[model samples]
Target: MPNSDMPQTRQHCYAYPHPAVTTDVVLFTIRQRTLSVLLIQRGTPPCQGMWALPGGFLEIDEDLETCAKRELYEETGIEGVYLEQLYTFGDPQRDPRERVISVTYFALSQSDNLSPKAASDAALADWFSMNELPQLAFDHAKIIQLARTRLLSKLGYSTIAFQMLPEYFTLSQLQSVYEILLDENLDKRNFRKGILARNIIKETGEYSRLGNHRPAKTYQVVNPSQVEIIK
Candidate 1:
């Protein structure tokens, strides 16, 4: 039975999902003792002329880390490095269109082998000194600050620093990396004592040649699974 007041059939509520879920990779590298972060110039609107971290929408059946690595490769032509999940960004107003939640990842790579080749969609991709980053799109500034802080704090008692360094490095080079990240000069004697006390570095019985100085011995980060530095 149709009633005069009921002029139409029942209407159902349809849900439109958010734009997409994505993962952004914040690749950090230490070159000549200064920390650097990777960024790319956007090729589209909403921040078309701005610099941004490497990222993109996740595939339908991809894992977060996989998506992060893929985006890194796509935007910067880099691959295969130690990457760790940093944090997630989901401020309602972060994206202009629909909601977007980006899972951020941090990675360490060798500055020598990395070559910045912008993807087809990116105007440019390059590494900038961490101290002199330009205005970034989205909440990238906040993400970079957080990553820098975490890297410094963790360096105090963790083996995470090895990720940013080559497999074999000199004590001076290692200390330099610490100084750049911590933003504080460390006494040579004290720094050596702290590192040696950890029993986490093994002398490789090899030496490295430098300009206008005596060759320095090389050392490697002892496997954490095999050595216990801090109790």
Candidate 2:
């Protein structure tokens, strides 16, 4: 049904041209000990056949976040993710078709097992490692760089990284997540000490044995849905 919320519009009201609005999503997940972002091959023009973030133009009645989620699902088949608004890119020359302003969002996933089936204007979908991204369409590369910087900044004070971890994970696995995202090696003992001191996670009284190493303790976040600053 057409929404009745908008008031009646007159033909002359469209006198001034307004910029087109769009929404793009940057979804990150860990796979094969590497951090990766989801990308889709554009089936239509502007940047046909080029790999880009999953996104599209917003519908007239839909809200910003709804458009973001819809575009992401239509292009990449990824859904039910918690998205955070990152920024707005309003460069007049950003789009070839028209003066387009894009609102971008980002999300973190705990599993990389998702299978992306391309639909709508997407020809293909795949994951690209952080250290190895393909030539992206539009200003997507710039958007990703900013998202990375923001993720790194949040990792220092918030439990945002927990979204990338399983319910029951070892301290080593936790440190690995931080190291992978930060692109640096962290001291295991110190990392464990500091994280445990935050009181965000609790010992589960279970252990995991990885190869020749002895069993390591397991822990789970005290509140899975709580997004609190540990610092």
Candidate 3:
């Protein structure tokens, strides 16, 4: 392997500075009929002690989605949940340290048994109700607003609402999720009829007994992969 007589080529590097790229994740869950978002208290300067979405600077070798999941896990001890790319925030003055761009993602999960432990650059990790959010660091408030808009829009068409529910749930529970996100009450008869008409959910042959009242049949999404726009 000593035939290296090709003028000894050298590696090239960019001469000009460039903006840094990072990733952020917005995790949403419903607890006690209230929609909440996961937030981390920043431990470092620029916005120390301020609550923000879980995220960090992207590693050079990592993909965007990979970076997002990794940051989420690192900061909040949460992983293996469904994540979707929400949008990109590249405002030049978004970050005070330097020119930084953040590619944000949104995730949905049931908060039944999941608890967050702070790590990495996070001093604390917890869920805050959407209706009562703390002062957010960076441009996270805007990012979260956008994510909320996307979540509401997607709920009307996609089966993503199920991601925030358990595998087996009653129709009342399912309807509650829609009602919480839509922020309004839906007609029980029409809601049931519309959901059943789509043929998206099927009975699981299980019934939940609710305190001397009639039992409610449990159901699960027929095809979690199928999404339909319902009006």
Candidate 4:
């Protein structure tokens, strides 16, 4: 006989062991005309000392995206950037320690604004060029490849590239970001024509005097929330 006001203890309904869940982040940025990714060196075992995407096990109290953001901040000291869930890796053999599943997220940020300091389970955090990445832990290399594919595909239809630029930038500066991500040089005439046709950006009537050349007119996204696919 228990008091009606007292909390009741719930009995276990099943005894099957559940797979441990984790979150990983793939942070990308453009620097010096090159696209790069943020990676951390693991300090703990099961691929200790290897470069891996910043991540950790999910906590019971957190949601998937919340866990991903928390792990990114804990490992690289980076927070408050645009993060989108990339994919899930559930291969039973992906992790050496028991059965684990990973929900990975990809983030975009301006490289000039980020200065990663390794913390938590990370021994070191640094940016690496997409073409010259070190050996990665787990299936992180596969995850990065998938992220790159997603980014390239999205560039044609979304305003995501703006995330790597400042609030106001010149057309040339914007083109460089595209060139870096696409890994190819674009014809200036055609590029400008296409961009103007799409009407995605608005001229700010401001010019950049940072370089020796004549000032270039600055522009910014007309509607940051709108997606006008590039032709």
Worst 10 contiguous positions by lDDT, candidate 3: 222-231
- Return the TM-score for each candidate structure: 0.87, 0.91, 0.92, 0.94
Residue lDDT tens for model 1, 91-167: 98887866889899988776876888999578899889987899999888999898887777677667887776778
Candidate 1 segments exceeding 4 Å error: 1-19, 224-231
Report the lDDT tens digits of candidate 3 across residue range 115-190.
Answer: 8999998999999999999999999999999999999989877788998888889888889999999999999999
What tens-digit string does per-residue lDDT give for candidate 4 at 1-231?
779999989887777989999999999999777899999999999999999999999998899999998898999999978888899999999999989999999999888789999999899999999999999999999999999999999998888999898889988988899999999999998988888888889999888976689988999998765444665
Per-residue CA lDDT of model 2 for 1-231, tens digit only, reads: 767997877675676898999999999989888989999999999899999999999999999999999999999888977688999999999999999999999988876447778999999999899899999999999999998888889998899898898889999899999999988998878988899888999999999998899999999999888667877
Off by over 4 Å in 3: 1-10, 225-231
lDDT of 3: 0.91
lDDT of 4 at 192: 89
**Candidate that scores best on TM-score:** 4
lDDT of candidate 4? 0.91
Better of 2 and 3 by lDDT: 3
lDDT, candidates in the order shown: 0.84, 0.90, 0.91, 0.91
Model 1's lDDT to the true fold?
Answer: 0.84
- The better candidate by TM-score, 2 or 4, is 4
